[model samples]
Target: MLKDEVLKILLSSGSHVSGQDISNKLGVSRTAVWKAVTALKNDGYDIESVNNKGYLLTKNKSILNEAEIETCMHLYDCKVFPKILYFNSIDSTNTYAKKAADLIPSDFLVVADTQTLGRGRLGRSWSSPSSTGIYMSLCIRPNISLEKASMITLITAMAICDAIEELYNISPLIKWPNDIVINSKKICGILTEMSCDMDGIKYIISGVGINVYDTEFPDDIKDTASSLLLETGTKTDRAKIISSAIYHFYEDLDTFMQTEDMSILKSKYESRLANIGREVMILDPKGEYPATALGIDETGALIVNANGKIKRIISGEVSVRGIYGYT
Candidate 1:
C-alpha cells in the first residue's frame, strides 16, 4: 500500500518529487519512501532517483496498479468508483462483481489481470490473456427502470470511445450496441448484466474487455479482433484507459439519469455510430432480412429501413460487415 501511495505521488508529479515532500505528505520516514520506491522499481516501474531532485516516474510501460489508477482518477477529479478491487487472476470480473455488488459499497470497480472464463455479449467467450489486456467490471446501482437500462450500455460505448480518442487520438466507433472498434476491428467488447426485481434494478455489472498489447488473437477471432498496440503501434497504460472511461461515464451520467432518455447523447452517439447509412443483415428468428441503418432512436434502439418499412430494433443479432468487413 505504501508503494501504491508512493506511485500515486510519482505519477501525479510533472517533475521529480523530493523524498522529504513525499515523507511529509504520507507521514512516513525517508527510509520508508525509499523502500517503497525500490519496491515499485522491482514491479516494473521506471522510477529515477536523483540525489538532489528526489524521484520521478521516467517512463511507464503498460504498467497497471491500484496507485496508478487512483492517480489517474485524481487527475480527472472523478470519485464515482470509491473503492477498487483488484485481482491477479479470476474466473471473471463480472461474475465477482455481481456476487459482491450487494456486499460492497455502490459504484465499486473490479479489475483482473486475466480471466479464465471471460464472457462477451450473447454468451460468447472473450479472450483475456494475462497482462496483455484489460478485464474489468464496474458495479453500480442505478434506480432507473428496465426500459431505460439499455441507455447504460449506449453510454458505456460512448465513454470508451471518448476515452480512446482522448488518450491515443485514435477514433473508435460503436458497432451499434456494445462493441468499440478501431479501423473496423474490435478493440473492446462490453457486456452489461444486471440483477433486478419487479420494481427496478438492484445492481448493474458492466464488464469490459480491451485488447491492449496482444500481438495475436485466437485463430478463431484473429480476423475480427485487434489490440491497442497493434492498432496504434504503441503500448498504452491500461489504468488510464479505465480511469478515463469512468470519468466520461460519470460526466454524462447526471443528464442521462435526469432525462432518462438519449436526448443529451443521441447526436454524440450517432456521430460515432459505425452502422449509420450502412447495409446490415438482421438475424431474425423467423428469417434473416437486409436493412439500411438510419441511426439510433431516442431510446437507444437501432433504427433501420427494412425495405419499405422503418423498424426500431432494441437488441438482436445484427451484422455490420455488409459495410465494414467486421463481424
Candidate 2:
C-alpha cells in the first residue's frame, strides 16, 4: 500500500520527488520510503535516483500493473472502476476471466502483459509478446438475452476504434464483427465469449488485444499484422488507451443495454467498417460464398450481395483480401 501511495505521488508529481516529502506525506520514516522505492523498482519500474534530485520515475515499462491501471481509470473518470487481476504472463486473459466470473463483480477485468497461449476467434493463435501489446478481458453480467450477446462484440470494436482515434488521431477501421484494422493491416482483435441459460444471460467476457509497440511479427503474419507504433511511428501511452477504451465501452454499453438494439451504434459502426463495399469470401458451415459487402444491418449482421441475391450473413468466417489477404 505504501508503494502504491509512493507511485501515485511520483506519477502525479511528473518530476523528481524527494524521499522526505514522500515520507512526510504518508507519515512514515525516510527508511520506509526507501524500502517502498526499492520494492517498486523490483516490481519493474524504472526509477532514477540522484544525489540531489531524489527519485524520478524515468520510465514505466510495466503499464499493465494494477496501480498504474487504477490510476489511469481514475484519471479517465470511469463510473465504476473494476477490480483488475494483473498477470506478468498467462495462457489467456479470456480463460482466466471466465474462471473468475462468478467470484468477481460484473465490471471486473483480467489483464496480462503476455499470453503464452493467446487465442482469437475460430481457435486461432494471437501473438502476445511481453510489454508490447494489451491483452485484457472484461467480464460483464448484463441482463440481456443470449441472442443479443453478439452485439457486445461489435460494441467493443467500436470502443477500440474510438479510443485509438481519440488518442492518436488515427482512424482505425473495424473488420466486420470484431477486428480493428489500419491501412488494411490488423491492429486489434476482439473475442467475446459468454455463459448463459434460459433465465437470461449470466456473464460475458470480452477479450481485446491491441498491438501497440510491437514492430515485428511472425513470417506468416508480417504483411497483414501491424502495431500502432509501426503505423504511427511513435509509441502510444498504453495506460491511457486502456482507460479510454474502458470508459467509452461502458458508455456505449449503457446505451445498448437500455434498448437492446445495435441500431443505436449502427451508423457509427457502419462508418468505420472496412469490409463494406469490398469483395469478400464467406466461409460458412454449409458452403462458401463470394459476395460484396453492403454494410451491417440493425441487428449487427453483415449484409452482403451474394451473387445476384442479397443475403444477410448472420455468422461466418469472412475473409476479405483487403483485411488480411485470406483467400
Candidate 3:
C-alpha cells in the first residue's frame, strides 16, 4: 500500500520531491519511502534518483499490476471503483472472473499478464503473450434483459476506441460487434458472455484482449493481427489505458442502461465503423450474401443494403477489403 501511495505521489507531482517531503506528506519514515521506491524500480519503473533532488519517475514501463492500475484510476478521479484481481499469468481471466462472480463485487475485474488458453469470439484462440498484451474481463451485473446483452459488447468497443484515441491520438475503427481495427489489422478483440435464466440476467463477463507491445505474433495470425507498438512505434502505458477504458465504460454503460437503446450512441459508433458505406461479404449459416453496409440500427444490428433490398443482419461474420486488402 505504501508503494502504491509512493507511486501515486510520484506520478502526480510534475517535479521531484524529496524523501522527507514524501514521508511527511504520507506520515511515514524516510526509510519506508526508500523501500517503496526500490520496490517500484524493481517492478520496471525507471525512477531517477539524484543525490540532492530525491527521486523522480522518469518512465513507467511497469506491468499490469493492481497497484499501478489503482494509481491510474486515482489520477483520473474515477468515481465507480471496482475490485481488481490481478495475476501475473493465468489460464483465462474470463474463466476466473466467472468462477468468482458470486464472491466478488458486481464491478469486479480480473486482469492477467498472459492467458494460456485465451479465447476470442466464436471460441477462437486469442494470442496472449506474457507481459506483451492486456487480458482482462469485467464482471458486470446489469439489471437488464438477456437480449440486451449484445449492446454491452458495442459499448465496450466504443470505450476501447475512446481510450486508444486518448493515448495514441489515432482513431481505430470498430468491426461490427466486437473487433477494433487499425490500418485494417486487428488490434483488439472483445468477447461478451452472460449467464441467465428465464427471469432476467445474472452476470456478464466482458473479456477484452489488446495487443499492446507485442512485436511478433503467431504464424497463423501474423498477417491479420497487430499491436500498438507495431502500429504506432511507441510503447503504451497499459495501466493508464485500462483505467481510462474502465472509466469510460462505466460512463457509457450508465447512459445505455438509462435509455435501453443504442440510438444514443449510434452516431458515434457509426462514425468509427470500418464497414459503413463499404462493400462487404456477409457469411451466415443460412447463406452468404454480398452487400454494402448502410449503418447500425437502434438495437445495434448491422443494417446493410443487400442487392436491391434492405437487410438487417442480427449476427454474422463479415469481410471487407479496402486499400489494405482483406483481413
Tell me, by lDDT, which candidate is best: 1
When summed lDDT is taken over every stretch of 10 residues in candidate 2, the lowest stretch is: 318-327
Top of the candidates by TM-score: 1
Instruction: Order the numbered candidates by TM-score, best leading.
Output: 1, 3, 2
Writing each residue's lDDT as its tens digit, candidate 3 over 212-291 gives 99999899989888998899997777988899999989888888987887978999889989888888777765667788
Which pairs clash (backbone N, Cα, C closer than 3 Å) in model 1? none
Q: Which stretches of candidate 1 lie over 4 Å from their true place?
A: 316-323
What TM-score fits each model? 0.94, 0.91, 0.91
What lDDT, from 0 to 1, does candidate 1 have? 0.87
Off by over 4 Å in 2: 15-21, 24-27, 43-55, 316-327
- Which residue segments of model 3 deviate by more than 4 Å? 24-28, 50-53, 77-79, 316-324
Span of ten consecutive residues with least summed lDDT in model 3: 317-326
Tens digits of per-residue lDDT for model 2 on 1-327?
Answer: 898889888887788999999999999999999999999998888899888789999987746677777787887767657788888899999999999997876579888999999999889999999989999999988898888888999999998998999888999998888889888788999989999999878999999999999989989889788999999997777877888999989888988877897878888889998888888878776777788889988788988888879988775444433323522
Give residue 291's error in model 1 in angstroms: 0.7
